[model samples]
Target: MFVPGTASRPPAGMMIPYTEQLIFTIATQIPFVIFFGMGIRNLISRGDPKALLFGIGGCLASAYEPIVDVMGFCYFPREGNWVAFEAFGRPIPIFVPATYGWYVGGMGYWFWTVLQNPKTTQQEFQLLWLRAFIINLVLEYPPIYLGIYIYYGYQPLEIGGFPLWFPAVHAASPMVAATVINLIAPHLKGVKNLVIIPASVMAYGMANAGFGAPVWLALSVDRGYHVSYPAAAITALMIYTGVWIMSLQLLPTQPLKINGMNGNGKSKGLRG
Candidate 1:
């Protein structure tokens, strides 16, 4: 249970009662179950399974958590009431992977659908990342504070007791994953659609490594320094890079219009 490179904080007073931690677990778990059901509904009723497969892949993507955690200086308490898996010394909670499935996979799939609309513009795509940033910041703050997971070292844009830089960079990951999946979507049909599952893991792995590398560079340097400014520049560049990558995907084809009308004023609807 003892992790070698684990964060040094978590003062003795930091460990709350397991009973209280269970509340956090169930709270996150309920929504994850709901998301799982939604994925199934999409598959059965809507005749689409990308979301479900990606959700499963997101769960598998959880396997990469410990590596990222250890390298990126993220920490999860080992004393948790539920431990799904442990690697490189860190013990991640069961809710962690559950959230990954819904938040990472579900949201990524949603982005994929949004991008499917040839009408969705580069500017709108950037706005989506902004929305993602706000959603992640708010959603992460509470659990990051109460759930007892944290980024331990030199964070660039630390805010509300949580590092803003991490979320900022993380927001674009779904976009990156979505963009990559859309490339192969046309060829995906029948059993081939199952490719989405591995694609989810592959996309997630590349996205995290690529988008997260900047802050990782700064964090790896500072360790316990906990300063900003210079680190902030790296953070901005990283976010901009994510936006640029997303915007580039929209370049080959131009978007139609704000209203669903293209050229001749014909009504057009978005497809996932």
Candidate 2:
């Protein structure tokens, strides 16, 4: 339900220097370079190829970026930037997908690494979410500061031109993918790792669109619906947060290390 004239378009005549745009685009790939490098090293030495597969998958997953931006009321600039692809009257920048691949793919790889630890605790998982949230805030801030994009509309909990709601969902998507991949990666021995390429993309969509359905629906219905955008935002935030926390609690528990007891201290599992 894309309502015409509802998107918050960047102001006309707004343009970033092409040099600056190029610089930003290259800078965003630093993490991808590092992560992809690590993935290669891991593949050669440890035979673990999840990271590499995820990086490639993340690059492909950028297709979802334009779709979500339309629903989320975001408008990426096309005036003086490298346009990756256009959709629904919006021209997304190349840097947008670059960040998605590096940020989501890289972070998802890292998060899955942590979840791989047999000694991981529930607290550690929550910490991963917090860290991703903060990193997302930092990554997104630079583009907005450079006038490369804008989040327009009754965006809930916006600060410094970026909305808080964006980071919450942005950060959670990688975790969702990482968690799902962790459950199945081990059984995929040898060439089996390649299968996760498409699966990771599926997880990416589920994490963003599925978990974010509440807010997406809210934004779509905000035009004439009696419900206020902020109220709908608040409700959606609670639901997203609630489901993530529940996932943490309900997932299988690790062999916790309490008071220096190491993995021997099994304690009461995650569900309890």
The CA lDDT of each predicted structure is 0.74, 0.74
Tens-place lDDT per residue, model 1, 140-210, is: 78777775676665665677668776777668767777887898988998899888878877776776677
The deviation in Å at residue 256 for candidate 1 is 20
Question: Which portions of model 2 miss their true places by more than 4 Å?
Answer: 5-9, 223-272
Q: TM-score for all predictions?
A: 0.82, 0.82
For 153-258, candidate 2 gives per-residue lDDT tens digits of 6666778998777788777777877877876876888788887678778877877776566666666665533443555566556645754663574367566677
Name the lDDT value of residue 118 in candidate 2.
72
Which 10-residue window of candidate 2 scores lowest in summed lDDT?
Answer: 223-232
Pairs clashing within candidate 2: none
lDDT score, candidate 1, position 230: 65
